[model samples]
Target: MKSWLWLLVGLWPAFASGNDEAAELLKRVRAQHSADVVVSRYEIEIVRTEWQRTVIMAVTEDQRGGRYQGMVIAPRRLADTLYLKRDGRLWMVIPRLRRKVGISPAMLSEPWMGSDLSNQDILQGDAVIDDYQHRVIARDGDLVTIESTPLPGRPALWRRLRQQVRRDAVPVRVDYFDQDDVLQRRIEFSEVGEVGERRLPMVWRIVPMPEKGEYTLLKVSGVEFDPTLPDDAFNALEQATAGTATSP
Candidate 1:
């Protein structure tokens, strides 16, 4: 019994060290993707077996408060459509309806504009470190895999997440799992390049599980980090009124 107790005590520090390393690695990963503000354009392509649809949008994000505003600017029909997120709440402005509707937490997991990306995925921003409890699960070469569980009382759609990040702090792939621990989707990040003072992935491929040969590709363009954003950027009322006036 004495030897067993000693062995356990001797292994405790190694476990603690692994967790500490995981936290530090995650911190670095977050820093690489962090900015005061980010302005970018995204081309989202939804490829199906029978058809393909593409949408273009301008995105402005305030990293500090996790506020984001996106305006659809393509396809003529979706033009002037707006989405605003602030303080963990999302609102959508439809030009045809001339009203802004709030998005409930239950609907956050739904696809965004028929794309594989979810509404929650857009609003997550840089809050992963704060929303999940992480531990190092595996390490291979220069890549480290971390397993994360949603923190108690946090509003998260994925019950668990497994992310593989490079030693240079670039996220390569992330797998999302549901409450029943079933894998739902995976997002792969690539096209690493220098954006301002940091390196980031400029392309993201999202694939939903159990659906073969179907995926959504999101390509980032015109990325500007720490750009000045308008004060009313995330205001739902302002966006709704603008959509109403600019409806064409």
Candidate 2:
């Protein structure tokens, strides 16, 4: 019995080592999506059982300061609407009302313009890397599945998240769960293609909870990485006052 106990103790280090390797692998997968600066044109479609609506927007991200900004350019009526995030602050600007409103922390979970995506989803980029504790839960062929739990005191909407990533560092799918361990949504990534120096999914399909017939599709129409984005590109007031439409 003592011999068996010693053997188990000796194997414990190997288990700890495996956990460390999985954490590092997860980081590499996240790094693939990171960029110094990124500018892209996106087409968002909100599909319902009886109707659908489409919106086109130009989005820019400055990874250094964790800033993101988007401006609506299409559908005429919704034109010039802007969403901005800088250093953890979020704001919305409406051109017609000439109003710039600050987004409260509680509103982060609300859907963006009736789409399946939440405001937090757009503003919080790569947050899983730092805000959650990750571990490898399973592996199949070239794909690795990881489960993430929010670290202590971290402010996250989902109680847990599961992600599947390929060996080539591409994120294939992600599942979000609530505090009761109920699955809330699933996001699938596809259309792998070259975007600047890296290959990324150009299409994202988001399906909300309860298997509803509604879903949201986001497609990247154009993208440029590490471009010389203007210093005030993420300033909500500057963008609203300019009243200039951006095209891909």
lDDT of 1: 0.68
lDDT of 1 at 94: 84
| Candidate 1 TM-score over all chains jointly | 0.81
Q: Residue by residue across 1-248, what tens digits does model 1's lDDT show?
A: 10101111111112222378777776666566556676778788898888899998887776666566778988799998988766666778887877777777677777889988667655554334455677889999999988877668976667888888888877788887998899988888899888767777777788998769999998776677677767766665444434423221
Model 1, residue 168: displacement in angstroms?
0.5
Q: On a 0 to 100 scale, what is the lDDT of residue 189 in model 1?
A: 84
lDDT of each: 0.68, 0.68
Kindly report which residue stretches of model 2 are placed more than 4 angstroms away from their true locations once superposed.
1-18, 126-128, 230-248
Error of 1 at 236 (Å): 6.2
Candidate 2 C-alpha lDDT tens digits along 141-240: 9998877777688776779887787878667888889989999998888998886567767788889988778999988788877889676676674554
